[model samples]
Target: MLPLLLVPPALSTAFALAPVRRPFAAAAAGWVVSLPALELPVHTGIGVAAVTAGALAVGPVTTADRVGTGLAALTCGGLAVVLARHRAAARVLDRAFEGFAGSGAVDTTTRTTARNRTPWPTVLLRPWPVRPRSIRARRGLVYGPDPRANRLDLYTPRDGGRPRGVLIHIHGGHFRAGGPSRESRAMLFDHALRGWASVSTTYHLSPTPEAGFPQHLVDIKRLIYWIRTEGPRHGIGADAPIVVAGSSAGAHIAMMTALTAGDPRFQPGFEEADTSLAGAIGLYGYYGRLGAETKDISDPVRHPADGAPPVAVIHGTDDMYTPVKGSRRLERHLRAGSSNPVFYAELPGAQHGFDAVQSPRYLAVVAAIARFTEPLAG
Candidate 1:
């Protein structure tokens, strides 16, 4: 009974160590185990509790029972080691930001006062990321004709003060599922606290007939057009620098959006509209062309024309969905063609959807982004 009780946590630890490789099941289980694994303290507590419960429920009455309890204790201890490894993400972020110095992107010497501290209390108490009362989210703002597909949720300071900068965040689901809500709430909340208004918008998914290839990119441009023309009405100032960011597939769009600014091809009917960005950031992104059928329509590397904004690409070394090699290729491409510096943070032991939780790894990432985007806000 003791060893059996320990089986679930043990398997979760194993999966975290070596992520599930299956296509369909990996997505679901990866997120399930990834959170506690990244947020070490939470996992530690759970592991300790499991061991304690198992020991208390089944005392060492027999030789097998004693051996089972010992094995459970060892498993709990091994998980602690895994949890401790999350602290190394700070150093990873530091090395990534090292490229900013003397590159003319942002002042590398300037740093944010924000510390990369994981909210352990909140992590243990709440399963999902929390939005502070100070930040107000305005949902269901239509950015295009399709009210549901082409809508955005805007997060602004509750004080209604003019924003210093704007952040446009796109959600990722391999270009199929997912939307603006409940994604990257940690990053959104953190920036909102820094007096920046952030937009999380949705795009038409694949197989939706009306959606495919560049259609998703067009929807993002439409949202940008709406922001530039109609943002003032919503307390966003005209001078506020707008930076784009996304996770996974959304990251591909964000990079392409920055690289193809004002290009008539992507702009479509709104060709004259300025869809430029102050900068862009990609989290666990995919940079290659979607497929042979999609070609360069979804690829960020193929569209690097010039005058590219200062970009940051952060990826997990352990990401099961998107490989880190793609991000490395993007970094090299941007360095060769981009007018500004390209910051690449290759995090160790990090898995996909890292920003969904306010773990130490993600807080470090948020800090790096804050430092990178601060000078743009000025």
Candidate 2:
């Protein structure tokens, strides 16, 4: 009972209420509060076992307590079913972009079994890899005037190269507390190993410095221009393809930028510069607006038009932060509105930020990304 109180029941209750906003320190627990809800089989098994043993030792609680226990049990069963379905995410990827490589090209048919295979059932629930070998990052290049706020980190293969494709990653913390070098390091390193350059960037957070509107977008646009002008010193050519990728709030920004490429309102001085992206990838993003529709670009789904770049969207069906329903909406709009293809994959039982580390499921998504952006390579 005590274990159950601390885990599924407690976390699930918080998730139901949905209170992970603002003055972030007070809301910090909501961050990790989501993990157990998605990976409930293990937590539920232990919790149920502990409760049963304790019940045998010290019998009978109130009717209300019994009712609570029954509800928790039901929750466990539902979570288990959802967890079982999560394995189908790879198939979702396969179906979404059947012609990713070329027309009539088949991908991962031989690798399908291997892609979803894991050494154990609880492999993903275990700790993730911290340091991947032969990956190097150059940290803290002063791209903007504010040193602490306007720095970026660049990652490349240990041997390195002037790769034709570059992935620019944006970190997510509700537009509050996260730096460029956090969360998606594993994804960046894996891209680097595949002979692609990866960038993790920092931009201004919202609602503290100013309202969460034009400032954040402006800073990102500035970074895009900087890379276009100065990318060659590190080997990204002027014509090289750029794919913008982000998770959570960062995903919203990535999708919005891809939808509204180079509107003068977002890019002040560099209004005329080439701010086009080869592709856009969103991981568990919400396309809601911050301010009044100051520009025509209010939300990605609302503003999506024809001729946008191809997009890859990955979301967890179990995600509560940015609901899977929202990703579904974005996917439908992109498919209907954009001239290029929109590939969407939904992991069944995974929660938000599931790919922050290295695991079989995540690496599979990384492979999907490799395929999605393959057409964009210059």
Candidate 3:
């Protein structure tokens, strides 16, 4: 988990200083952590795996234990000092701008306002590409009443033909920050253009500090049931294959849903429900036991007794947040099961959130998905 601890701070710094630098920093951090340690290979491996998965799932750097918290505090304090110093420099720059204005060369208020309005240099430098009409026109939504949770967005092809397949996407924000609206638009567009309808939904987050685990999974199962029952009306037929794709916390949810397919524990509301998913796509998700010998971290929500799903695992080689090994291990476990297809891809120099978002790496992932789903669509 050391990687998880490191990622947030590193990402925050990269965002503050230069957004363009984030991918590079994240990649570098992932590589640095991948090297084998000199002694205690097993322990190092476990720690590295945990840290990497945590980083990918949570973001940035992670630590193994509580002592890392103290170090993190110190790091935060140092950053605060640096930020104060930068503010002082900004004041000097403001004064210089005033001097130039005094010479009757520029309108001070307008110039200052413009400067203030300008987004961070990082955001400006790495502007996302404009999507084509084939991609952009596919966005749509589906809503249901959940007094406790947010509504869902269902993105599909604008063309009136029946969809070839469906992908239910789950967004990630540690199960606290993000919502369906923040789900990757690129994935939705790619799937839509590839003759697949993509359903992205919101779940209840950890509104209180004490909330965690089962609640998130419960919300996801409800969404899954809704999709299975309601998708036919939306041109996504019940017989059409359905895949669950999620990143970070969403990845966890997708895995849980796949594992619990057809299990009575997860079945409710829908009669004759065959929850067997066509496949599952987990992007830098948290896997492995929270404690030693605990493979199923989600107890009642995701039990080992539940059959596993056909899975496609995509992760960055240098992902300090979620180690690539977790995907490797998951593939191993799934392979040992009854002939489930498990495809694993490790991207060089990529990091967490590489596949879903608008990065160059994300585009490549979209292409890969398009290629993978082509035969199924046919």
The estimated TM-scores of all candidates read 0.90, 0.77, 0.60
lDDT of 1: 0.78
Query: Per-residue lDDT tens digits of candidate 3, residues 248-273?
Result: 77887788778777655545555356
State model 3's lDDT: 0.56
Stretches of candidate 2 off by over 4 Å are 1-31, 37-83, 99-110, 119-126, 208-210, 293-296
Position 306, candidate 1: lDDT: 73
Model 3: runs farther than 4 Å from truth?
1-150, 181-183, 207-210, 289-307
Best lDDT among the predictions, by candidate number: 1
> Considering TM-score, where higher is better, how would the candidates rank from best to worst?
1, 2, 3
Q: In candidate 2, residue 229 scores what lDDT? A: 86
What lDDT does candidate 2 reach at residue 313? 86
Per-residue lDDT tens digits of candidate 2, residues 66-86?
A: 655676666566555544554
Judging by TM-score against the true structure, name the best candidate.
Answer: 1
